[model samples]
Target: MADRVLVTGGTGKTGRLVADGLVWRGIDARSATRRPFSADQVRFDWADDTTHDAALDGVSSVYLVAPTDRIDHLAAMRPFLERAVARVPGRLVLLSASSLDRNGPMMGEVHGWLDAHTSRWTVLRPSWFMQNLTTQHLPSILEDGCIYSATADGRVPFIDAADIAAVAVAALCDLVPPSGDHVLTGPEAMSYDEVASAITEVIGRPVRHCRLTTRELAARYTAFGLPEDYATTLALMDETIATGAEDRTTGEVERMTGRPATTLASFLTGQRAVLGSAGF
Candidate 1:
């Protein structure tokens, strides 16, 4: 039988895609969600330790995604991870951020711990996801025909989540064992304004990009009903964006997947309808 792989945050965007990719390759993959997910897999929750054993049972690999916006997330994730490592004795592929190398607050904690953890593991430190612009944030932009953010002159090699998933699949199945962090990015770097222009070119709509102050961005997030700390963290991420931290591409995805990473224009073209829509 194929070795079972457990996926944390499996219902999430990247996690779901990674799980699907594993399944497509005829690998035994299971998704772990907060509550009982409807898919034909074991239900698990990080908040509840009782669910861990059943999920990790017979699993030879795990795709780990820590909770966001927590600077000390390593402690919170430690219990679950310790249990999984001790019990499963398999590969652990952690989903981390590329910005962690520069001491970015929240992601850095997870990055630090994962790097030091002595086990068979692979860390996927991907740049800002192209999906964020299309799947999550584009609705608001499309509604007003303008996207508001704090990023000003920052350029980021926004990566495709599908590419990240593909890399995860390779890491999980490869026999040589996964090692070191894989910093993945798209083919090129582009600023938010450039990203907006790409959307306009694909959708044939005049989409405007607006740069806001960090405080203003925090206020906007607060108005959207997110908690204060989370809002501040998001604003800080935007500030990091404004600093041009993510303005670089890497060959990690191509090295693993044997294909060039998808471009922003290509991603926008595939997601033009969603970008044109006002609601999800």
Candidate 2:
């Protein structure tokens, strides 16, 4: 049982759910956020080392959600993580991406750091979120009945953020800490074209996949206000996906949480009202 778990990015997609789950299970969950809007939330910023110790205070476990603004996640997070582990002597569960394998880059380096620095750690490498279609792609869908991607027919088994959180909650609450990474994914893999078709079927609206070259996609991301380097990196990931990098599924979610991961169809059904409300 976690004496006190500090969930960084408490208001974020997975962090919020992880915090709620921990609290529901009767563990003390300290939600760490730079913008504190409620009780039990402590100020925490990866850029602000001054806020680190306070967030780590009395915490027996940590749920680390890296900052999104930077590509060099290890440089931004390592100091706080080191301080956190040194002070708390507890388990640390990091939220990473399935695209980033252990010791590869970014969150991968953080995973390696955890492996070398502590015995109590868990790394969650979840695939793209199913919610991305409802949020990130929603604007594009609303603007035009199309989903744009640089990935040409690449299949991805996008996992729900809820499933990721379920596994994270279990990891954070476990008395016996897990020692390695879990590569998580949904049960089925589908391409961007198939995704558009699925959305069309679910919402009763026609939608198409608009394919682009990686360079074009990177330009699109830059136009939308991402750093050029980061945008290029993200677009390059899509190129990698095109080569079938994200084409597989894994049982990590169900294996960890003792429940089958949610399917894309079920997730879409649950979000039908939202999808339809947008005049789909």
- For each candidate in turn, the TM-score is 0.92, 0.97
Poorest lDDT segment (10 consecutive residues) of candidate 1: 102-111
What tens digits encode model 2's per-residue C-alpha lDDT throughout 1-280?
Answer: 7889999989989989999999899999999998887779998889999999888889998999999888899899999988987887678999999999888878888999899888889999999999998888888876788888999999999999999999999898773248988889999999999988988898998889999999999999999999999999899989989999999999888778889999999999898877666654
lDDT of 1 by residue, 54-78 (tens): 8888888889988753546676677
- In candidate 1, list every pair of residues with a backbone clash: none
Off by over 4 Å in 1: 69-71, 102-104, 175-177, 278-280
Each model's backbone clash number: 0, 0
Model 2 lowest lDDT segment of ten: 271-280
Q: What is the lDDT of residue 151 in candidate 2?
A: 92
lDDT (0-100) at residue 209 of candidate 2? 97
After superposing all C-alphas onto the true structure, candidate 2 shows an RMSD in angstroms of 1.2
Q: What's the true lDDT of residue 221 in model 1?
A: 86
Q: lDDT scores for all predictions?
A: 0.79, 0.89
